[model samples]
Target: MLKDKVVVITGASSGIGLLTARLLSEEGAVPILAARSRQKLAEASSGIAGKHEIKVLDVTREDQVKQMINEIIADHGQIDILLNNAGYGQFESIVDMPSEEFGRMMDVNYMGIVRCTKAVLPHMLGRGSGRIVNVASMAGKIGTAKSTAYTATKHAVLGFSNALRQELRGTGVTVSTVNPGPIDTPFFELADPAGGYTSNVKWLMMKPEYVARKIVRFMDSGKEELNLPLKAAAAMRFYQLCPRLADRLTYRMMNKK
Candidate 1:
């Protein structure tokens, strides 16, 4: 269904972004890979099949983000899909995390999506049809220990996506969010250096390819929200229905891993 579609994916250097690019390419999508590292982007694009492009972009920088969008349009004529997947997770206690680190997290994870979305929205609106997929996290829906900064940014992404989805009701532009649980990617190494969290939930962690395939499916289905590993989604829903019990249950689940 995505064949020959002009899709742009940020954070295309590794993890979910890189895998998603590969899956989309197999479906015949022309993906433009974007990341802060040109070398990394080149390496990731090298293994991808078919004709794809690359852009060295730091979404936090408004100028670079805007330039990338303009260039993509100039080169491809239109952007059919945008996967705002450029982000990182910083797991640290609120008191231990420096204010600058918190600010940086918000800038790259939250504001970065805002800037990229803004840059592409006008063109999508003009075309009267487009797909936007924001890769948020399950943490966006529920907070966890040592994830203050990361959780806050994801929450912002969720809020932004929700508002944007409602606003674009009649514009023919659709917005979707992917709330993935722990994925066994390099992301965990940085997000949890101690490996405690990952080891505990090792069995539950979804594979990057698994998450990527689901996301690719959503792009065509126009699914508003996707929560990987149905069990996790059910737990989150239970939390929504009963905060007290859910909180206690989450604590137990985390430690049980």
Candidate 2:
């Protein structure tokens, strides 16, 4: 089903986004790599074998998001998929986190998704067939210490996806969310500069390729949500069912950073 499809993937410069672009290319899909770095996007596309395009986009900017979407539609005639994968996090307690940093995180993580989705929705709705996949995190499902800002952004993403999915029902456009646990990627360099959280959970870290494959599957699965690392998904469900007990246990486990 993905063959010959035009996929627009934000954050396509690296990590799961880049990997998924490669996989989609392998499946004969035309992946449009979108990111803020033109150099990085070029480098990422150079490695893929099949047809692809790269767009310089800063999702935080409404103008850029709108322009990118417009250009994609103009060039491709239609966009079959939109993968909102551009986001970052900084792990810090609320007291220590700078207000500016929190706002920036919100802008890039949550509002970025909003901007991109709003820009692309009109095109998708007109065509009456498109898939919108959002890359949230396990943090969104279960809050932990030192992740107030990051978790809040992801929680907002989940809420947005859920509501948007409902709104898009019967419109032939679907909204899907990918909630993955810690993956081995450069993201932690910024999110955990101290390297404490990475070290503490190194054993549980998943490879970017693993998560990327799951994301590719989700693009056409018609599923609403994809939570990774069976164990983490189970834990999220447990937390929802037993907030008090899970809070004590999860806090002890996640507070090691």
Candidate 3:
């Protein structure tokens, strides 16, 4: 049952992770909020009316990830679910973005998820039960302009989720990926200081609450993957199936904008 389940959520300070934490807490799950900012975590914990824990964790750090998992197991006995939702975007063109910044984007969005997953697996395997819900983006399936680094990182996330799901299949563990479109959250505002926000996302933005509802249901149902905003998912699938046409059409639409 979701009630009392020990769910650890990364990126819980804001956006989708924060929303999910609050929603799950309302549903009776003991949501543990994890992020790099302690103050924000504290504020979020206090604002929420349910029982939850907050931890200052930089997902890109190996030692911190390991320590957090060990600590959670010690306190909670077992981790019922792990939400690898902490991520940032660098919406810079390849020419403008330096190698160091590009690498950091990979470190946070891609390696962050990898490190968090590694830390939780040993504990879950020992108990032979757990769930992992990864927040990927529709960018993973279809590339977007001026977001090469972010897109690549999300694609890596999707690849990792796919492989991990197969490896853990039938082992009393399940992995699911949430591929969401543009969400009307401060995620873009916080991540991109240059206001490099692409024009492509203006019409397609969604609410974090919408995605939170999906996350809760996806966890309960043990869904293999979810491509949210049904129409967007459909279009992306078609793009994957017909890259040439998708490219031409997307380029034309983008040019018109």
Candidate 4:
């Protein structure tokens, strides 16, 4: 379904973004790989077999985002899909977390999605068809200790996507979110510098390729929301229905990080 379509992916240099780009290329989609580092973006797209483009983009910057979107439109005629995947996290208690660190996370994880969506929306609306896939986290649904700031940012992402999806009801523009459990990615190099969370949840980690395939499937299907690793989704649902019980039972697990 994505064949010959233009798909712009933020954070396309590595992890899920890079893996998804490869998958889209194989499906005959024109993947526009966008990331902060031009070198990294170029290197990431080097091995892809099908047609793709590399554009340096930092979703946190409004001007850069607008210009990049305009350039893509000028080059590709229209962008069929936008994958908002540019984000990072720092896990720490609210008291121990620097205020600036929290703000930075909000800017990238939440505001970055806002900026890119805003920049691309007008074009998508004009064309009357487009797909926006945001990569959130399972943390967005269930808050845990040490991830207060990160969780808040993701919650904001989910909130933004929920509202936007409703607003675009008949506009032929769709908003979908991917809320995945901890995936084996370089995201932890910074989110869990002490290696505590990584080690604690090593067994639960999902591979990036697995998550990437799910993302591609969502793009084709236009599913409203996708929660990875069925077990995690069930746990999130249980936590929602019984917060007190969840807290009592999962306190030890939550504190492992």
Candidate 5:
């Protein structure tokens, strides 16, 4: 149960993270909101029914992450869960995308998770009880157009989750990863300046609230590797099995990224 449990969430200012911050708090969980945008985090904090912490954090900076984690641990006494969800994707072709931009993506989307995990692992392992939920994307499993760097980071998230799961096998701590399909959230707007997109036609496009509810539910279940919107997972697998035929049928006919 999430009730009264202290959980720290990153990338918590908007979109799925914001929805989760509110959801968890209402369900009786103590949410510690971590993000770079103080204004946004403050605004999000207002929506929750109960008290929650708002910690300003820039995940790309390891020093800040270390200090922030230690501060939360110091204040809260115990960190029950760490939600590694702070990330964004840049829409561009690999050739035209600046290498520096790609590096920035890895720094936040991949290294950020790494830094936070390292900061919390000792405490969790020492206590022999904790939960770490990482939010990846469908792009982690299937290739998407215009998401080369984003896809790479998400893929790295998958690898990181798998390895960490193995390392914590005997410990009381639990690690779970979620791969969500297209959700009707600010992410698409953040990724594209345009108002309309056809690529998001599939799966009825879940809402952020829906995703958050499912995540909290799964957390209660003590599950590993939640493949959300089951149909998408099945389709990705089916596409992979078909090889070039799938690529030609799926990507060859659609917009890149």
Candidate 6:
């Protein structure tokens, strides 16, 4: 179903987005990679098969996002899918995290999706068909210690995606959110500069390709949500049912950083 479809993925320079691009390209989909780093984007796309394009986009900037989408439409004629997979985590207690850093997280992680989606929605609505896949996190589903800003941003993403899904329900544009547990990616190198979080979850982390494959395979399948590692999802569900106990345990485990 993805064959020859024009799919645009933000954060395509690395991690899940890069892996998804490779998989989609293998399925004959035209992948348009968007990221802030042109050198990294070029390097990442070099090994992917089939036709692909890259756009240097910092999703926080409305003008840049608008320009990238416009250029995409001009080149691809239409966009079939948009994957809002650009985000990062900032692991720190609320009191310790800098206000500006927290704000940047909200800007890049939350507003970034909003900007890109708004830029592409009109085109999708005009065409009367499209797919939007948001790469959310398990933190969005259940709060964890040391993720105050990160969790808030992801929660906003989930809320935004859910509301947008309802608004576009009858418009043929489907929205889906993928909530994956900790993935073994360079994300942590930045999110946890001290390596505490990574060390704590290294054994539990899922590979980027694994998560990416699942997303690329089912993104347009009309599914509303995808949660990784049934075990983690089950635990999160339990947490939702018993917030006090579960949250306390999680806090103790992840607060060491």
Candidate 2: C-alpha lDDT: 0.92
lDDT of 3 at 119: 92
Ranked by TM-score, top first: 2, 4, 1, 6, 3, 5
TM-score of 4: 0.98
**lDDT (C-alpha, whole model) for all candidates:** 0.90, 0.92, 0.87, 0.92, 0.85, 0.89
Error of 2 at 17 (Å): 0.6
The regions of model 3 sitting more than 4 angstroms off are: 191-200, 254-257
**For every model in order, what is the number of clashing pairs?**
1, 0, 0, 0, 3, 0
What is candidate 5's lDDT per residue for 55-95, written digit by digit as tens?
Answer: 99999888999999899889988899999999988778889
- The candidate 2 region of ten consecutive residues with least summed lDDT is 248-257
For candidate 4, the lDDT comes to 0.92
- Cα lDDT tens digits, model 3, 1-257, are 69999999999998888889999999999999999998998888887899899989998899999999999999989999999999988676789889898799889998999999999998888889999999999889988677788889999999999999899987888899999977877777755554435345566768779989989988899778899787798898889999989998887554311
Q: Alpha-carbon error at 24 in model 5, in Å?
A: 0.9
Per-residue error for 232 in candidate 6, Å, reads 1.0
Please rank every candidate by lDDT, starting with the best: 4, 2, 1, 6, 3, 5
Give the number of colliding residue pairs in candidate 5. Answer: 3
**lDDT over C-alpha atoms for residue 21 of model 3:** 92
Q: Please, what is the TM-score per model? A: 0.97, 0.98, 0.95, 0.98, 0.93, 0.96
- TM-score, predicted candidate 3 vs. hidden true structure: 0.95
Clashing pairs in 4: none
| All models, RMSD in angstroms | 1.3, 0.9, 1.8, 0.9, 1.8, 1.3
Clashes of 6: 0
**Candidate 3 local lDDT, residue 127:** 84
Error of 4 at 135 (Å): 0.7
